[model samples]
Target: MFTKKVVVAYNDTDLSNDVLDYVHEILEMHAEIELNIVYAYEHPLENPSPFQRNYDDGAPEMLAYAEQIIQKAKNRFVDLPNHVEGFVYDTGPAAAILSHAHDHHADLIVIGNRGTRGLRELVSSVSRTIQTKSHIPVLTFPKFVQEEFEEEYHK
Candidate 1:
């Protein structure tokens, strides 16, 4: 099936870049496609410790950072003919991406699987949650898998 609208989950991480690299390959095949890049970030002080109760929430800074990253992501597609747009949300990543995809009627969701293990995995596995919960088709690119693809492509 032809994919017209795609929702991409980006957060300026290496894993997220891997997803973008894969998306670049997809763009080569689909000449007419619309990309909606979404970056969701949470406030650093959302769960501040008791000792840091008076610290500024830094929501504005975080949002600004998110916007910068989204802008950089948009720049990556600037030369391409496909339409590209970026979005920044002050919320959880998985929830924001799913909601955005649904709201925009996206045909696909492209995300990077961080492959975090142990405690970190339980605390922050956005790709897994998104894949399971999203009604739209989800494409996940793990870091190792991307590396392998690059290696093969160079050979």
Candidate 2:
């Protein structure tokens, strides 16, 4: 039996669930494994005042959103026999995930790449940054585009 300590960057977006599901299936085969699922609680850089928008209090709104997202992701691993924990960090995704992995002595980091177009592509850069900065291996699930996953699988 071997052990693996994984830090999964959790998000509940449909694409995010695809990666999370993939990880869960892998962990099921392990005799000993621990999952540290983390969600980076980030407020938009352009939005300074949540109060001015739809938030009652900016900080709490941010935290609450993070909590909800992490909770949804956690539900996916409920049946797994391995130890699973969830966390939310009010920092950039790459920085927060890397720091938590290093501090917790995680053996690997798993993140989902939401392959977006135009302005959104900037976000995928975080995965690249984490891979470069981390001493441990980072596995990123490339976002499914169109019928690529289905087409490849059917063959």
Candidate 3:
């Protein structure tokens, strides 16, 4: 029976899908609440090395990828019980999520427990930072639970 707005930190991951489905279920039960779906991105700093120019610019590609992800999410929840809004930011995922929640005065922040793993996990500073620094209430779902959540929602 929470009336506060909920913000979901979305990314192209199984956990993100779970967070979305959980938010959808919450919305179904609390029709007065609002939902915001956010995808965050951070561009790599320009390197001084000559080979740096050959590397793909992360911002534009990430933003495009985020848009596609958002579209897919929208299609998946086309008949959602509550209206959902999508947001894309070209900044660090944790920072963007925290900033957005503060700016929008969100009551809850939802995200996946982990997105990358092994070697990639070591490089994911944003998620780590969010987990440590965010002041708002945060809910994290494991990847396996996300799959079950999606199946339940789709069925």
Candidate 4:
């Protein structure tokens, strides 16, 4: 019986929806534990590290996109238990997620594996860092889980 809080790192992808479904299932089985849905954003600083800065210097546009994504997620899971809280943070995805989990004292962190392959996977520094640096348990759902869900639904 897992009693500690559970945090789900939600993006606006189908993979995120699958993770939410898994969280919902866990909630059904373990009603006592708290749950939180967190969405990460890439923040902008006047003098960001070279690697951290985006080409457009469009922090406002990025924040607007994040808000849209978060709103969609909130609407999708609107009926979650009151203990569940949704959060939006303007920090790099991996750092924001890890920090939120740590700050909230979450027992479990859940996210979707984006299924980056070959060269794509090698270039994903943030994802690799998160996997290595997280202090708490992190669970990643396979990318194909969404396809499986779609197939089941269509049948």
**Going through the candidates in order, what is the number of backbone clashes in each?**
0, 0, 0, 0
Question: Model 4, 115-153: lDDT tens per residue?
Answer: 777877766744566678898887888778557788999
Name the regions of candidate 1 deviating beyond 4 angstroms: 44-52, 117-123, 145-155
RMSD of each: 3.9, 4.0, 5.8, 4.9
Tens-digit lDDT string for candidate 2 (7-100): 9887677767887888888888983788988998666455547555654347777888888888888888888788888899988888899999
- Candidate 4 weakest lDDT stretch, 10 residues: 73-82
* Candidate numbers, best lDDT first, in rank order: 1, 2, 4, 3
Tell me the tens digit of each residue's lDDT in model 3 across 13-57.
767787787777777777778788888776655664676775556
Best candidate (score: TM-score)? 1
Q: What would the TM-scores of all predictions be?
A: 0.82, 0.78, 0.75, 0.74
Candidate 1 per-residue lDDT over residues 1-155, each given as its tens digit = 47999999998888888788889888878868889999997756666789987665676777788889999999888778888899998889899999999999999999988678888877779988898899988988876765778899988
In terms of TM-score, how similar is model 2 to the real structure? 0.78
In candidate 2, stretches whose alpha carbon ends up further than 4 angstroms from where it belongs are 1-3, 43-56, 116-124, 148-155
CA lDDT of each prediction against the hidden true structure: 0.87, 0.81, 0.76, 0.77
Task: State the lDDT at 105 in candidate 4.
Answer: 92
Q: After TM-score superposition, what is the CA distance of residue 137 in candidate 2 from its true location, in Å? A: 0.4
